[model samples]
Target: MEAENKKLDQFTKEVIQDAGLATPSVDFLANVMAEVSKEKVPVKVYKPLINKVGWLIIGTLFLIFSFVLTRFSLGFSILGDWDLSSLMLEKHEINVDIPITYAYCFFFLLIFVIIQITMISKRFSRSLEN
Candidate 1:
């Protein structure tokens, strides 16, 4: 066993001497850094189809529509029986008895959640594509 170990050590020394050591070029780091800087990193720019003003207008219109629908469904006269001027004024007692506002809020939240889920799904799909 001692003789075999000596022979293995001698063989290892000879193999290491034959392999020789290597040195990198002086410009190797600079070249690698230059290549890395030149590489194009994808910039994800989220450009929505509908702008902020358009979305605001759409949301305002939808809310108005919902209000009108709720009033009509609840057997209330549209702008006829409920005097907006008198309601705003201190003369008439404001009737805040509609339970449908909760429903409307819930519906709006559901819609927003669905839209967010769709947008997230599209973003993930686009990332996978890249």
Candidate 2:
């Protein structure tokens, strides 16, 4: 049996050698590389929701608000005796009594939100690949 198997293997090898190996075109490597290079991989551009101009506007508004709040607090009205009482909330009337259970619930909610965001991002990325 062993002699027969050896003879068969030798015959198969001889036949394969006589069949000759396939030869690629002269510029096969170059052509493949060129094709690979030509392939367009979609790229996601990074664009902030708030641009520099938007940030500048927001910062200017914040500064203006701070200035107004400061002047109003010190009895120095920038609006010339304009009642700024509406802008300032009365501290005495405000009473908040939140339960510890609410804090735990909010904490759990935050964890769930973070997990969901990660899962959603991964799913979107995988979908884009296909």
lDDT, candidate 1, at 37:
100
Q: After superposition, how far is residue 92 of candidate 2 from its true place, in Å?
A: 27
Per-residue lDDT for 13-130 in model 2, tens only?
9999999999999999999999999999887654679999999999999999876774456566668876655555563377798899999999999999999999998888777666
Clashing pairs for model 1 are: none
State candidate 2's TM-score: 0.46
Best by lDDT: 2
- Clashing pairs for predicted structure model 2, backbone only: none
Worst 10 residues of 2 by lDDT: 83-92
- Per-residue error for 127 in candidate 2, Å, reads 25
How many clashing residue pairs, candidate 2?
Answer: 0
Candidate 1 regions off by >4 Å? 47-54, 70-92, 95-130
